[model samples]
Target: MGGGRWTVVLDPHRWLELRRFRGLYESGAMSLREIAKETGLNRRTVAKYLSGRTPSAPPERAASDRPRRRVVDEVAPLIDAMLRAEILLKGAVIHERLVAEYGFTINYQRVKMYLQEARPRIAEELGISPGELAGLHRRFEVVPGAQAQVDWGDEGKILAHVGIPKVYSFHMTLSYSRDPFCCFTTSQDLATFFDCHRQAFAHFGGVPMSIVYDRTKTVVRRHVAPGEAVPLHPEAVAFAGHYDFDPDVLAAYRPTGKGRVERQVLIVRDHVLAGRAFSSIEEMNAAFTAWVPLRRAKVHGTHGEVIGLRAVRDHTALRPLPQSPYVVAQRHLRYVGKDCLVAFDANLYSVPAFRVRPRQLVEVRATKSQITLHATTPGAGGETLLAAHSRAVGRGARVVDERHWDGLPTGAGRRVTAGGDLPAPLQQRAQDSSSGSLMALLNRAAATQVEVGRRPLSVYDELTGTRPFTTHPNTKETP
Candidate 1:
């Protein structure tokens, strides 16, 4: 308190000096000048610091007692507003904006320091504590196979040169072991989501007791009011049922709940995708597969154990995979064509003529090797099978069954061929024609249709008063 630069709270050493001076003065062993000379202070300043009635101990000053004027002080309200709006603006960005838009003349470092102190207060006002902020995520561990966290990370413009704008990675990490599995996909649709789950399960050699997922639409169908159970997508429920694992969805706006997979997404990006170019999702996935083994061998930072060793314990605790792998078939509503076929995957699949009408909506359930069509029925089961066709291997292929078109008009129905064509009866008749004398026979048969009088050349000769069997007009012998 004696000098502008010193306060008991800000400069505890100066408080110690004050205490020493007070002690020397009280003992009557040293003059104020002597204490000042020893402590390196003016006698008046030393006396001012020692003026307290009985210096017991330096009292800790309240944080509010610190100097109030700051560059951030002028913009604290703005920063508070930004934080309250859930805008995660960086301190440097805020500083630049303050300079450009608000004409703030303060330095960036002061603004940054103020922001660090102000965020806790701002979060408190928003009904969330500083510890719950996005940056101050807490770490928790789950028992082996007790849980696994799933997440998706977008790799932007990864294959832009090959015409792909973006790709996503599905990541799943065992909570206890921190073991991770990731795969790249061009889509985040329900099919791809379920497919990723299967891939991760296969990689881990089994399914976990429960899998935690973000509030993605593929997992959580909708966000319900607080205290109400979060509704899960029906397909997701079916998939979990098939695997005999529970699906745990994190609450809305709480990605840290699935922190294991969230952190692994970053690790995979940095280790596998950083500075890497891929022409296809398959190639990116291959890269991830090759790099994941390296990660598994490294020592985990938090667990302080070899990840592969920990993962061995995880795999042993995981639930055994079902006798059959869960089939994740993509469902789509397709209009049946007039040819008694439904189009799927750029291939035409036959639907029984009696089962589906032209332009009627039929649900196509497509798996890797099969495409099954189901017609919605009014009964309890909801859908009736129309047909199941072998999945086509290439585009523009037509897969048909002859029985499907049994009800078509008589000649309209034809034998099915591997080429997907229905051979017409006329084509069959042409194929059965004899090879020899075909041209001459065709000419003679064509002459049968020509009109000829009964008299023939003799009638023409009598009409002209000429010989009846004249060989030539120029001979004139018969005349």
Candidate 2:
């Protein structure tokens, strides 16, 4: 502590220094400046540092001509070897090994600092700070029509009767423009999965040059050769092939690489999905469609103040969408009822009297506008024509033989007597219960009337009353 620039003072020495400084100023033997110079500090700083100080470290070491024992030469080589071998991998481990192997005792903290200064840790201490990650979405800049990013999201529904306040989401973003689109689906089943993408692209007003998607089952094979990526699922691969654009599957576990799409999902979640609800997926989609135009009109963070205009500008470069949105996901298998009616959903629609008894196996390709049925394998009797339903398909409904001559529904009692019109016994059972009763009758009612479709009431009656229903002329039910 003597004459070293102001020393760190401890306990009694600090009290002594303060006393000495006070005594000196009072006695006038030496100016504060002289005391400070002797202490090897400028006057004011010395006063600040030493005025009330007591010497702490056993006085300062006198001038040392000799070097201290070499910590580096003794330990650095072993540390280097461990690092090269990627062993003794951490500072604590290195310190422990040094002591265990060479009796080289070192402070744990000092070793930690030394390792930090000497080598880079390959593993990240922190992949991203939450604040930085939060701001990442703000960092994205996209080009128009060049790329699209996609991910699955939750659907939010208010009164879904399959029973839950459920909603499902499959969302997409334009990579170049950062424009976003999201839609709902009841299932990730192939049909709805592709339908969602179709809806998203249509909302964007164009397809992207490339579509970036995380490897959902719809798109990925789920297995791969070592060091080789898994292939896109055939259905998705086919969809992409049809569009003539690259289908970019993001690397597994690397959201950072697909940060743009990831960011867009958050955009839609915050601006669109959050706090939003719908009576059903259809209603939710209607709301989503309405919001898309507003979102499209918004200015991007890094880009100019307008949106849809640029979308239009870059849209021309995008591959044109298909004339048909179908992905050929249709399956051909006959679903027949015991009464010889075909079953789809829960409804039983009639086939011709000859065609009934056992359901015919027919391949059906369903579209928004048509259900084109084909004879995948003719019935056992070698039925000539696959039946077609006059009414739309629903569960409990049937597709009848086109040549069945429009016979009365099997359960239909006497015909309306006048063809071209239904009979009165076919009228809703006057004794119909508080709930639903029959699928055929209900489907028929639904087909005939929409808003007041007795279908729901009849279904409630059917489902609630009994596990099964009594049989009538054409249809069978539990009593």
Candidate 3:
């Protein structure tokens, strides 16, 4: 055979053969011809493999020399612009915008491939570090009782079989000790959120110096742009002020700021909820209580210390709780209906008819157990408490107090006997007054009065000695 240069491509089978041949040749147990016969390769081929230049790893396949067309090439500039504007822009969002705004017809796979190559280049141009763009963050440590992180997990449909539409898990992790407190709830309202916080503090036996949280509406009044001041909810501020703690709101789009509680959320789900069914929120909470001791006994992977023992240090360092916990209420403004009732939460709570007029605006403060209605504008008497009632458990319920309707008519004056005649008290008042009583004279005078007849204007004018107008028959006009 005429060959300038030859290469042997050793696929897996040939590589194993080469290994066997090397073993046999080194052992000196068989001749090259005999080894070739055993391997079904010619003696020269077997000897060549035994020489062992480790079958120059099958010549790396050369890349294509021809130019290849890509569907995403035309949209490269658009993708680059998006990545530049928001350095953390996701590939899926870029694909969606390309399809919707730019009428792109390429599949997502091509867009994803293009982004895999283009994202780094653009991020580098914008001076964003590769680690930052890759979501790499440095771990932080806090002193005992210095901070606590709070987050909410959507345990959707976990309790749906029991008629609850949704369920949520509130998680609090002490930053230093990795101490965890979680409670299940059916609502995420302002009142329930702080109530859970109070429960967590009670469980920990103290409150941390500060609590970290996401930009939840219950904590933040409104969302602001990055680097702008975040406005805290008035109730949240009041609650924190009462407890002598500060609220730390995490930055927008940054969950790693509170990664401790974030990881605890998953751990809790794995330990307590997986493969377990709960009929009520109370039952779910009880399960968590049972699992806490087990969790505390284990050495934390990050800190390498027993969680319960570390929590002892954490608890000792925390600030003592206030003498009395702050009261949390969800407030709303409603006008009194014509029926003397104010509607809230699909239920009606009554206001005293005398205290609140129809259509008067009032503030409704709803706590866990009671609903209190207060007049928005107190009168000169400075009376604001209109009425209070137990919160209704079911919808379309009307909770009313009978005393609130005391002044309204109840058909008592119009009551009649079985014979269709007035009752005794009304009959006595309606009977004739001829028994020499004081009412008799008034009745006699009224009976003797005569009826007055209609009179013409001329007759009245003549009686009063005044001039009367006379009309001429031909002119038919008065002068």
Q: For candidate 3, write residues 1-479 as lDDT tens digits.
A: 11522355546754554464465468775678765655455566666657764445432222468543345678888888877766556666567567655888766655676787788898789888544334676799999999999999999998989899999999999999999999999888888899999999999999999999999999999998888999999999999999999999998888999999998997787666754578999999998998798789878999999999999999999999999889888889999998899999999998888777788899999877689999887878997788999988758999999899989888877853333444467447646545434333334443345454698888888899877566555885546
Mind giving the per-residue lDDT tens digits that candidate 1 earns over 366-442?
A: 77667888886643566588888887865799998999888678775555443332237644554577742333243
Worst 10 residues of 2 by lDDT: 123-132
What overall lDDT goes with each candidate model?
A: 0.75, 0.58, 0.80
lDDT of 2 by residue, 1-479 (tens): 34555455444542444344455555665566755543333466545444555344322323568653333446776776665544225565467557755788654544564576456542233232122234332245555677877777664454466465555678776666666677766556566677777877676666787877776776786856556977777777777777667788766665665666666656655444443344566776676676667667667776765667776766666778878765546444666555556554454445455544455575655433335445665667885455555436334454555455355365656534322334456444523545444423444544444335346566776778853444556876658
Ranked by TM-score, the better of candidates 1 and 3 is 3
- Candidate 1 backbone clash number: 0
Winner on lDDT between 1 and 3 is: 3
Please list the residue runs of candidate 3 whose C-alpha ends up more than 4 Å from where it truly belongs after superposition. 1-135, 412-479
Output the number of the TM-score-best candidate. 3
lDDT of 2: 0.58
For this target, which candidate reaches the highest lDDT against the unseen true structure? 3
Provide C-alpha RMSD values for all models, in order. Answer: 16.6, 24.9, 15.7
**lDDT of residue 425 for candidate 3:** 71
